[model samples]
Target: MTAVVSNSTEYLLGQSLSSRDDDNHNIYTNLLYLDTSSPGFNDPITFPKDPKERENLLELPGNRKVLIAQPAVVTDVGDNIRHYTLDCHGFQYVNHTTKCSKEMFLDETMIKASYYPEVDQLIKDVTGASYVHLFDYAARGPLNGDDGDPKINRPVKSVHCDQSYEGAKRVVMSRLPDKAFAEEVVENRRFQIMNIWRPLEPIYKDPFAVTDARSIPDSDLVALPVIAGDYTEESWAAEPNSAHRWYFKFAQKPDEVLMFKCFDLVRKRMSPVEYFMLRLRTGLKSICPHDKALRSELVWFTVNSSSNQIHDRYL
Candidate 1:
């Protein structure tokens, strides 16, 4: 994707990337990429399960910053972005309006009761899956020290995919009550682990960006270990590549939904890893005069076309 550079000005951290013409189609920003210069850098970095320990390692010097030019996503091209399927581009955008109230996002009980069903139906509609199970959801906000809510987490800054194929299988087994059924599904049934992301309010900072899966090669993927208590899981992180093409919806609204595939059992030709990174790109400086934080929410759904009755133990 080629971007028309309207201005030659350089951008620093926390600065605006918009041009003077107010181009809504592209933004230049810095994104974190894995640093492969260190010896044995591909070796898994163990992240402690404890939040305090994890926070200490958040700013580890293992990552390198790269200036990335992400084009604004054009939703009106053809079929309302349906051409960019999970199988093709690893991500899709849909103009879906939700019935859940904003207050429902604040409480876990309300989120499970109201928002979960909404997400389930949305996933079923988009994927045409016989069954859609929402496993987890996270409400993320800016890195404010005094939020006081444990449910709200700081937005992730690095370029990474959520799960690896083996990690996804473990998640399936952990969520299913019947061990036999879980094994069967993992071995035979084709499934996908997808993330549905939406902004709770209009996005002005920290815009979410995803790279076209076709642009990424398998050689760039590096498996990183995540230690959670007694269990450990692997996720994919990528080294910087010049061929990568990034896209994001400028000033994404609450009604817009970005659905991306994290792991797809059927699309084995292309790697199941879906690559994405979020950057703190300040929107049009004139409109966003005040530097307020941004808030968004994401839900993970396990989708399958199976009609079999398997008991699910939601985690």
Candidate 2:
């Protein structure tokens, strides 16, 4: 059952936010969810090292199909898009104009020299993070067809978050070369692992969608093991929930960026280790409507930030 809730400003499925008068700009599509009904669903592992095997495991018997109405970002409305935040919605869309050319993304040197600084500043401006460390960046597009670019990674269609709470902590500790500094940041300071995503071209098909973090309950998130070579890390895959609200911007431009939180460490009474283990996890949702083959190319930057003073600039 689908219900459309509307207001003078916004239109949503379960809740109304804001929308343009001319068009609601909501897209109805099917998003893949974890099939809890599958036999032996207790143990589910994804092999990132082997794409074919992972795809086979994630499809058909393992996937639950659900039709979703994703609300588009109403850019015409005043400050409507800015209302969504990492603390509230787990994702936010911002207008950021980049000086780097499209061709610059293809080269590693060019990307580091031209594009990295832009992303570094963008994260700082958005989050008000005192220290920002950009650890990784990757370009992703269609799997079968490549536009002669070797650096492009395949787009993921599953509904999953990039990191678990434990996984996020591990990333912070591992990425920092100095063990003492890592421990200090993880223990005393508040930190967040965020991803900045921007389309390399105008989005035509397979637009990226993110769930309202408020709509997701702890019960719906299932921690899954992601195996990469010899190492294993935990990530989250969400079970289908009727209450889940998804949103995306149609025909998203290259200048626009989607900033979302993977893990956020806030001040609390619990010990850092215990807190990370016991706290309910929150992550950015990766929802794509795979009606047509996705020809979109996107650049993703994973940035880690701390509330305290700056230590190392880039790691």
Instruction: Please give each candidate's TM-score.
Output: 0.73, 0.71
- Model 2: per-residue lDDT, tens digit, 1-315? 011122111222212212234455455444445665666553535445564554454563423333233333322212366566666766767777789877677677887888888887777766667677777676666433354454665555556777677777777776777889888877766777767777877754445667676777877776766555445666776776767776766666776677666677676547645543223223435433222222222323233443322123310
Local accuracy of candidate 1 as per-residue lDDT tens digits, 107-185? 8888888888887777776676876767777776553323555667655555677666567777778766779977876
Top TM-score hit:
1
Cα error, candidate 2, residue 272 (Å): 16
Model 2 Cα shift for residue 75 (angstroms): 12
List the candidate 2 regions with Cα displacement exceeding 4 Å. 1-22, 39-79, 147-149, 268-284, 287-315
Full-model lDDT for every candidate: 0.55, 0.56
Where model 1 places Cα greater than 4 Å from the true spot, the runs are 1-14, 17-23, 39-83, 143-148, 267-296, 301-315
Which candidate number has the best lDDT? 2
222 Cα displacement, candidate 2 (Å): 0.7
Clash counts for the predictions, in order: 1, 5
